[model samples]
Target chain A: MPSTEYRPPRPFSRIYVEDAARDHPETARVLRRFSRSRTVPISHYKDIFNRPRQEWRAQKESPALILAARHGEFLYDASAYTPTFGHKRFHYNALALNCVYDCAYCYLQGMFPSAHIVLFVNIEDYFAATEAALAEGPLYLALSYDTDLPALEHIIPYTRRWIEFTRTRPGLTVEIRTKSASFNRFADITPTDNAVLAWTLSPASVAARYEAKTPPPAQRLRAAAKALEAGWRVRLCIDPVLRVPGWENAYTALVDEIAEALDAGKLEDVSLGVFRINRDYLKHMKRRAAPTDVLYHPYEKRSALATYTAEEHKSMTSLLRSCFARHIPADRIHIV
Target chain B: MIILHTALAAEARPLIRRLGLKPGPGAPAPRLMVGDGTALVVSGTGRVRAAAAVAAAWTRLDATGHAPSAILNTGLCGAADSGRHPRGSVFVINACTDTTCGRRYYPDILLRHSLPEAGLHTFDKVIHSPEEARSGVRTAPELVDMEAAGVFEAGTLFLPASHVHALKIVGDALTDARFVTAADVESLIDDAIESITAFAAALRAFAASSEKSGRVLDESEERALGEAMDALRLTATQRARLSAAARHYRLLHDAPPSPVLAAFAARPPKSKNERAQALDRLLHALNGV
Candidate 1:
């Protein structure tokens, strides 16, 4: 059985700085925060991050920090499987590579070869690329795709900068989705309608069992409520729902708790998705996260996608749709 | 299993006596000494012998279906300065460079041991003179040894860099290298046996934890999932997913119901989507969701 004992966050003992990024102001600022850590200079972040024989599971226990400059393409269209929420143009950017939170079912376990977080110090490059894309036409972008930017707001403050940047750009719609409870960073800033603070919510029990180091559902809901009151467009995501034992009761209680906490009319929308993963990612996760119940569940695979049976997906999504429909309008819910 | 490699019998003697390892009868070259879930190999001296010995030990272990979870190279080394790091002080070799090939190997410092750490230079010959030691010092080596790089290279061939470790006890200073004797090497390693033993235990624990993370499916569960997939005539990807789903189902629930298996057996899924739908239903039913 997996241990339930709380493990404190392991600080980065080493920080790798890329030669191209070493002179940047952001790099200097981040380095100052980790003065005690031993700094190792490298030609590129991949020298250490992509080295052979790295134990992803073990490294997650104490991940190092990689400060690198992103030189190539910074943005890409969202994959077909990712829900676009009825947007005509949907895209995502990788400002950072890996996440700090260790969710058991996170696709990152397979997507990334290493668990170390790579924060591209040059945020201007990403903004420039997005602005260039917006020059052609309006764009809908997910800011925190590969990593949780809001959770690391205290470190990088990318979310705050993105919000400020979005204030000037009229054609750009930015979505910052996170499972973090660090919402106080938005207290001083004026909320923008174009910037949506999407909060990923799971049942308290599910979060406790599978989402390691993430804030509990109650805490996330409170953050979401705070965002709504701050005039920010907030999206509630009850996503990748696992079929854990007594899931119906667990989800029912979660929906009821969310309904009681926030103003239903204020939510931008609720996105519903049952547990699904890339087939290749599921294979890798199964090997790495063998002890976790959510990862081992028998899933159906179609066109490289692994998810619950179609019937199970329908029943679970329908059940949650009905539960959510009681409090909010049915048209506001998007199922994936 | 933990595999300990040493350059000399003297260096291995202290560990053998402390760990209660007995010489295995008819053991192959490299002198295998076996204990409870642990083995020690005397690699003689020089980098070539050390590398050969590690390969031999790994091969023997593999033949017996016992791959080493962790490999540790422990021996005496010449300190850059006796005044700085006193004789008999143990230092973990974080980086190993072979002077002959100019190839550097880094051992992952994953475990937090009690001993201090330093860079190691593996030289073909002993640095007897102060001038030679100074030349070695120009490379910024803290410790000088004969077999650390060789051991590290061979260890990585079988185990990951994280699973390989090197601990060097300062046997002599550059000025005192020629004066040192085999008895001094034995005494130096003997002096640090307590710390070495603790380090060995920690390495074992690390290896155990790593193994626990990459666990395979149980045999019975694997069989059940295979049977279910075969009945459905699913594609390769479908079979893999169905197996994962079955494993997930078993993880959350106590057991898989025979009725579900019988139902699946009676009317097998004909199409890929049908197979996926059936598998998903099976998991939900097993999880009682």
Candidate 2:
């Protein structure tokens, strides 16, 4: 049976603030938000985030918050694994190091050593770095690669700030992807042409089985519909489509449901990709995480990457594309 | 198994008696007591000795194939401020600092416990006065001990940070380390015996329930797996792939892949090509092709 158990979001019981970032305005604001949580001071966020022998499962159950100031290297070139949506200059930055939702296929589980959420309080620095890069040419930046900024909008107005910032910078375009359904947080903001609110919508069965602590697909569709009605450039991501049993029927039903709920012509684009990960990251994840069908899949390992065999990938992508092509134009469907 | 480490024998005596632990036959260096799935080690004074004792005891206990799941460091400590944490008050340490090296270790407290929590400072030398205590530690030292940092450093090497804990009983006022008599130390531990045993039990339960399930094969199936491997005559890479495939099969079906391998076990491959084909067929079957 699908899990109908209602899980109230677990609050951070403890907050670790870096000594240098203790007096930052963002840190102070977050402290005010979680006023009741115990605050511990640390020399650096790495002291806790990179600690040895950290139990990722236990920490994920009740994750703590670490606020620190990022010093250098705020922007990184986008990897081939992530689709760029036809952008020439694609880069991503991590305002937060870890995510709030615990998807079974999330690569962050293997990328970071600790499960604690580390929020960098220096947003102005990231903005300045982006502005510096935009001087040469047009830039497309991914602001929510390592975390769901929209889910954490209540904690800090990062998504709103980035959206407002992107409105004036004609050479800059930003993509903020999330599994959150809380669109009311941006009710007051003006819709922007350069900012894209990408929502990852999975099949109900896949979401129930693999995506933990995320809003249901129905709610996510409602949020996407609201965004589309508000004249925002919204992207529907059916990416990382899992090849579970009866996946074709599940994905077809999902596509039909989405078509019934929202107008397909208004969407900016639809992104599609099969599940894949770094081979080393999969090894680390398998060592630390409990057994799950997704993690334990015998993926075809090839040159630092682990993914389904070509035949399986072909079969999954073809099934999804044929169904999605019914509503969305073939030109608007991007296969990463 | 839950293993307890104490700096002094007096500190360990109360737990040994309360938990009904007896002398465990192993190495005689650290002096181990074991019974009822619990073990206690009397690590001598100082951080170095405590670290060495914990490492030694863990190695010895793990050699028997029944490895410890959790480790608890229980001992008496000096309260930096007597008014705040009075004599005989027990506390669960949330973080510990080593004064000599300025290194810190935070124990992930995931289990539920009723004891009050405090930060600890493990100093090499005892603080003789309030001034010494204030200057010796980097910050306000609520609880002062000599083995907490050492215990955490060594214990985490064997288990996860969540499974390593420290419970301290305040016995002095940060004036002198040797001020408390052996009887006084014993009484301090005796006063907190209930809390210690309860916390240990919670740790043991957490460790027991947190063990990963649905492994590729169990103890009873190891011999059969070995025989199958021999029958298939797989190379190193093929063997690893088979093991991974078996794990995936077990996760998907909640049953071992021995039944799938049983088909190939009776027929040995005559040539390298035949062996490769056999491996491919077994792998495809295990992978749910």
Candidate 3:
């Protein structure tokens, strides 16, 4: 269906999900294959006994897990970051894609054909590949390309797995990018010094509206607080800060929540980015969400992208930096 | 019979599966597909590597246990300019002239085939758009790819011109930059599989239909074969004589090489004006005046 055409969420009784442990066993388990029209024969459920299972059991199918199908062997991928705004990022890879949760602004929806989650079950292959790549030089790996880990933590348990995996590989660090505040799960697990638990945050109201199927902002903060309390390194992301109504209050309230739960000392860095896309994506969003003021903004063409006007991006980032700098140091706050 | 060959077996398996085929019957590495006459060869992904594959298949077919009557090169291709052609489509190059070596050849064409002639292009790197795609269209090479040269080169060693052809699906736009989606590209594979099936069926039907017409070759068949040899950049008369030698003379013996053609091949005689001057030079030499 055209993204402009509202697709009622699909629910499937059974579908095939590919995820395995023993590769990046430190990573969360990926479960896919349930959607609106597709169904799995009950025999398939019994056949599950034939395969191993992991913790990340994302429930929503079709627009849920098992997003699309692909035919190829080794994925020809390498670290690709913007040439200009080269964030202090060494490298990246596709560990997982099109998260289990459905956030409105997610790029996966436009990228993937099927909304079905595709958990590449061959964890060993990915691990061997990642480990071999890391052996070449010191680098950082970005995890949770599509969804937050903690939410699927109960099922996939990917972030915790990465924490464990990274500890074994020297000169390797990981940034588990996510919005889920399910940090309590790691309270008992040993925290890795090489791991940076980056918590993706949006204002409370934005989370409530756009971040459906995701934990509330407070819950994510609680998770961040637990990661801090557990002596784990941390980073904060105030990315894609939507210019919703009461934008200032929403962000201010979010800062207050973080201050209460997360201590400044525990954070390695903080990133504040205004909401943006490649503009073409916004066209679909505009059609999908008609008459939504947030969809239609005075974005400019920068680097062939429809981004916040220079002034808008500058103001949003500056305001967010100021908000956090009041509680932290200027060095700790970063903007991209 | 859809014969897909690659230097790599592992890479070809996924493509075969996507075509709704399963490795059938054979125990260790079964090339046999009981479901359909779809033969996939995993030629390693490269020029020299795939060239070896095409050669090996031709070798195997000649005086071997299993031999195929026809061949089709199938796989993904990076479009030089994919933005102009978003959906994956078929490319049929009637003639291919490589500018690097100044070698020209007509690749075998499946006539009246249901495919589009999108022109030719070259890729130094993975091309994603027309702006980035090599300007091969002016010469009108319907599609430009790495493996086709190997396929055409090897197919000529054995198969009749009617028995060989090259086809590809636009996997990525070949251009200066890259703009592609795996999800989008794979869907083109699906479309490719559909057309490939239809083309395979039509060719097979034609071949079967031709058998009923007896062993007497048709005039178009003779001309098509001649065109292929011409694309090989052989002089027209030389191509005709050589094709006749293969068809009627059956002369496998080494024939004396042509000195005049050899001299022209060595220097190409430059442009038409330069060649005209060369002709005068040649006439003076011939007349000894």
| Candidate topping lDDT | 2
CA lDDT scores, all candidates in order: 0.81, 0.85, 0.53
lDDT of 1 by residue, A1-336 (tens): 111222213457667778899999999999888887666555677766766666678778777888999998988999877799888889999999888899988998877777878999999989999889999999999999988999988778899999999999999999999999878888899998789999999999899988998988899899999989888899999988888878899999999999999997779999999878898987777655436766666567788898998998998998999999998898999998
**Which regions of candidate 3 fall more than 4 Å away from where they truly are?**
A1-12, A17-64, A67-89, A287-292, B1-289
What are the DockQ scores of the candidates, in order?
A: 0.28, 0.36, 0.01
TM-score of each candidate structure, all chains considered together? 0.82, 0.93, 0.45
Task: Quote the true-contact fraction of every model.
Answer: 0.39, 0.34, 0.00
**On residues A234-335, what C-alpha lDDT tens digit does candidate 2 reach at each position?**
998987888887888899999999999999878999999999999999988886665577887888888999999999999988988888888889989998
CAPRI tier of model 2: acceptable
Q: If both were scored by lDDT, which would come out higher, candidate 1 or candidate 2?
A: 2
Write candidate 3's Cα lDDT for B82-121 as tens digits: 5554446676554444433434444323234546544343
**Which candidate number has the best TM-score?**
2
Q: List the residue pairs that clash in candidate 1.
A: A296-B248, A297-B245, A297-B248, A298-B245, A298-B246, A299-B245
For model 2, the stretches where C-alpha displacement exceeds 4 angstroms are A1-11, B176-179, B213-227, B254-256
Q: After superposition, how far is residue A192 of candidate 3 from its true place, in Å?
A: 0.8
